[model samples]
Structure formats: C-alpha cells, structure tokens
Target: MSGLLIGYARVSTDEQDLTAQRDALTTLGVAPERIYVDHGLTGTNRARPGLREAMAACRGGDVLVVTKLDRLARSLPDARDIVAELTAREVKLSLGGSVHDPTDPVGRLLFNVLAMVAEFESDLIKMRTREGMKVARAKGRLRGKKPKLSPRQESHLVELHHAGAHTSAELAELFSVARSTVYRAIERARPAAPSAS
Candidate 1:
C-alpha cells in the first residue's frame, strides 16, 4: 500500500482493445505511465515482455492492479507461481477494487479457490471440444485441413516412392509440401498387415 500502484493490462489479439482495462486502472489512481500492457498476446503466453517488465518493476509494498483475475493469468499453476513471486517481493495483487495480500492466509485461500475454478472451467471446455470432435468424426464431418496434394498426385507419388525412383525429400519438393507430408501419404497408402491367428 505504501509503494507505487503499478498496473498491468493484456489483450489476446490485435483486434481486441485494452481501453476498458486502461480506464479502470486509471480510475484506480494508477498513473498512466506506471501501467504495462501486453497487446496482441494471450494470457497463456508466459513469455510476454510487458508482463515480465511489470513483475520486475514490482518491489516491497508495491501493489499490482489488474481489471480482472483472468487478465493476469490463465491457469492455476501459473496463478500460484505469480502469487508466490509477488509474495516473495511483499507485493499485493489488487483485482478490480479488492486487494489480495499473498502473505495473509485468507487472501491466499481466495486466490487458490479462484485459480482452481479457472482450471476447472478450462478442463470443461477441453472435454466439450473433444466430444464435439468425436461427433463430427462419426458424421464424416471432422476431416481436418484439406491435403495439399490431390488423390491422383498422391497415387503417382506413392508409385514413384515404391519404385524407389525418388527420395521423400524429392517428392516433397516436387509436390510443394513438407517432407513429413510425403511420409504420411506413403504410410496411408501401405496395406495394413494381416493379423496372425
């Protein structure tokens, strides 16, 4: 509470705006110059330069303010690591108007609860996505990106490969694709081995 009120803001994409977060921080008496921003970067991206600078700028009694908890971190472990760092430096994290002192048991508990909720929400999203993908696959609608090579070209490529006339690299260069693509096409063309009784 005694040190400077440092603020951090982030937006996930270039199209998103940070105006609301900036205004909120400004309203909280955080000086415009003291605010750090990581524009066009995801909260999941831990190597954000602005975030690193903001953490490094924090010192004893300093308060790090964010408009929301999600704006600060994306996962429970990430949140806990950040809290630990701030605690070690004796810095407080102020979410909106509520100040969380990591040194205090109540504040630590609250932070952990919120982080767990965030992690739970992320897991639900992943599970739902997997289910959706499964359904799409069953319906023959889950085909991924279209192959760079056509079936005719693939057949020709496979024929050439079996004849040992061209290397995988050569086929990839001729087909204008990555060498891995050539390998995958060859693998798919191979007949499945007959199961032994």
Candidate 2:
C-alpha cells in the first residue's frame, strides 16, 4: 500500500464512551495500529497530539479518517485549512464513512460547500452570543454570571443569623436554596460579628 488508512477518534468529556466510534472505524476498514484516539478534549481545540501526529504522518495518497468532520474540527475555516493542506500533498479526506478525495472535481466541490457551511455556523454563533448579551443587559442584568448573593438577600440572611431562629439547614430549606448557600451566608455574616475579633 502506497498510503496507510488511519483513523482518528475523540470524545470531549470523561464520562463519554468512544466504543461506538472505534467500532465504526473498524468496520470502515481501519486497524487498531493505524488509529489515534483522544479522550476528554473539546472538539474546538486543535492542539490534540494524536491528531497532529496523524496529519503529519499523512503523505501523498494517504487517507485521514474521522467519524465526523465536527469531531476533527469545530469551525469551517480550520477544516478548510486542513483540507487544503491535505489536498496540496495529494492526500484524501474521509469523514463519516465517506471517501472524499479532493483530487476529483466532485469531491472538491463537496469540500468547498462543507467549508462554507462551517464558517457560516461560526458566524451565526457569534451573532447569537452578541444578541443574547444585549437582551440580558437591557433587563438590568450584568450580562455575565450572577452574583452568589444579592445585597438584599445577604442583609436578610445576616439578620436571621443574629436572631438565632433558624439553623443553616433550616435557613436553606426556608429560602429554597442549597445547604452550601446557607453555609456561605453564615460565613459572610459571621466575620462582621463582634466575636470574630
């Protein structure tokens, strides 16, 4: 064989299982020795060591296999860059069990369309993020993570602590908050008391 048929697989979180992907790639004719796998890494990241190694090992007429294009790259621009590089070296790009060789005009067109869609998806995400922030800001929200405690709630918590009427667990129950919240409230109020000195 002039080129090796290699497979690359990944899953973002530790809890996720990659058995299915491995099985699919095996059925697609890739062997364990030629497979590179990564676990608990985000799809948006390009710094995967195994991925880099596979790409570097790819020579003229080699195949770079991925279960899905998204599993290989997050956005369209990056996909295009990788695809372009592979095409320049006479490499083939295969995804989701499909053989796509850029040397052929039909495959080239498919790659181009896929790249465009990826770029468009990224732009849409950015635009939605901006609009979401705008909406939150308009409603007097800070447009980021909310504070652990509001000023009014903190004051009430402090007063209750002084009264000694409710235990931390009881306060959590009363306020419909977590036990951790009650503990945090007590800590925040405790320092201000005269006995802490």
Candidate 3:
C-alpha cells in the first residue's frame, strides 16, 4: 500500500503568488487538505511554521512532496538536514513527482547537485541586489527616507520651543507634526554642553 502524499510550498515575498505551486502539488496526487504553505517566508529561514507542521505531519512510509527542491530549501546544509530527518523517520521525498531514494548513490548525488545549484542561485541574487543598490546610490536614487521637516521649519520650531510659549503637544499641533518630532527638533538645535578637560 502507498503512503499518504504530504505537500509543502513556500514563497519568499507577499507579492509572489502560490496558485501555481498549489496546482502542481494537487496534480501530483497530494490532497488539497494535506498541502502546507508558507507565504512571505524565504526558504533559507528554517523556522517556518508551515514547514514545521508538514514535517510533524509526516509518518513512517509517508511521502513529502514539493514542486521543486528550491521550494523545500535554498542551502545545501538545510536540504541535507531535512533529507536526513526524513530518511531517519522512514519518510520518502518526492521532488516534482520523482521520488528520492536516499540509499541510492545516484539519487544522493543528484539531490546534492540540485541543492548546490539552489544555493548558488541564492548567492547570485544577493550579489545582484547589492550591485543594483550600489548603482542606485551612485545615481543619487538610493537616498533613504527624506527628513520630516525642512531646515527653515526646524529652526522656527526650535525658536518657538525656546520661547516657552507652548508645550510639546501644542508645538506639535502648531507644526502639524508629532510631539516626538517637536522634541527631536529642539534636541538637534540645543547647544552642546561644555566638556571638562
């Protein structure tokens, strides 16, 4: 008798859709109710709740299925750890319908190669992101969030604060900003205290 097919799926960002993965898992004979998913969670993060649940749900002779190895894990160490746990528990793994036999030399080699590729892809993505950010900074397009108040406005706010005519809340209301902003402006304008030699 065949074991139950438990499926797992994951997406790195909230913007990425899971419909295609779900469809694939269902087509691979995993029941819709047995499919677990982690949204807006990276495969490198081992603390995924859905993954934990899926692993806990597996029993001896059960099959854990994923559309791709990258969906299961992005690092070679993580992939090997998960496979080891599954193998120890006597659970089988099905990657895109191809069952992985851990005892088979060819299967182990193929799984290792796939895991290396996933990790390499992840490293390339990080490198590209850093390069893109560097270029954007050079172009003056990567300046962080703009200040909440202009220099002139901040000076006026400081003057008003020193006059003692209004409380922090009143200043905030007058400037149409938060009381924290008023306090910050006053702090920035304060003269540095004399330091002892």
TM-score, one value per model: 0.62, 0.63, 0.74
When sorted by TM-score, best at the front, the candidate numbers are 3, 2, 1
lDDT of each: 0.86, 0.79, 0.93
Backbone atom clashes (below 3 Å) for every candidate: 0, 0, 0
Whichever of 2 and 3 has more lDDT, that candidate is: 3
Candidate with maximal lDDT: 3
Clashing residue pairs, candidate 2?
Answer: none
Q: Candidate 1 clashing pairs?
A: none
Residues 53-91, model 3: lDDT tens digits: 999999999999999999999999999999999999999
Off by over 4 Å in 3: 145-197
Candidate 1, number of clashes: 0
* lDDT-superior candidate, 1 or 2: 1
Worst 10 residues of 1 by lDDT: 188-197
Across residues 82-154, which tens digit of lDDT does each residue of candidate 1 receive?
A: 9888988889899997998776899889988887876776677678989999998999888988778899998
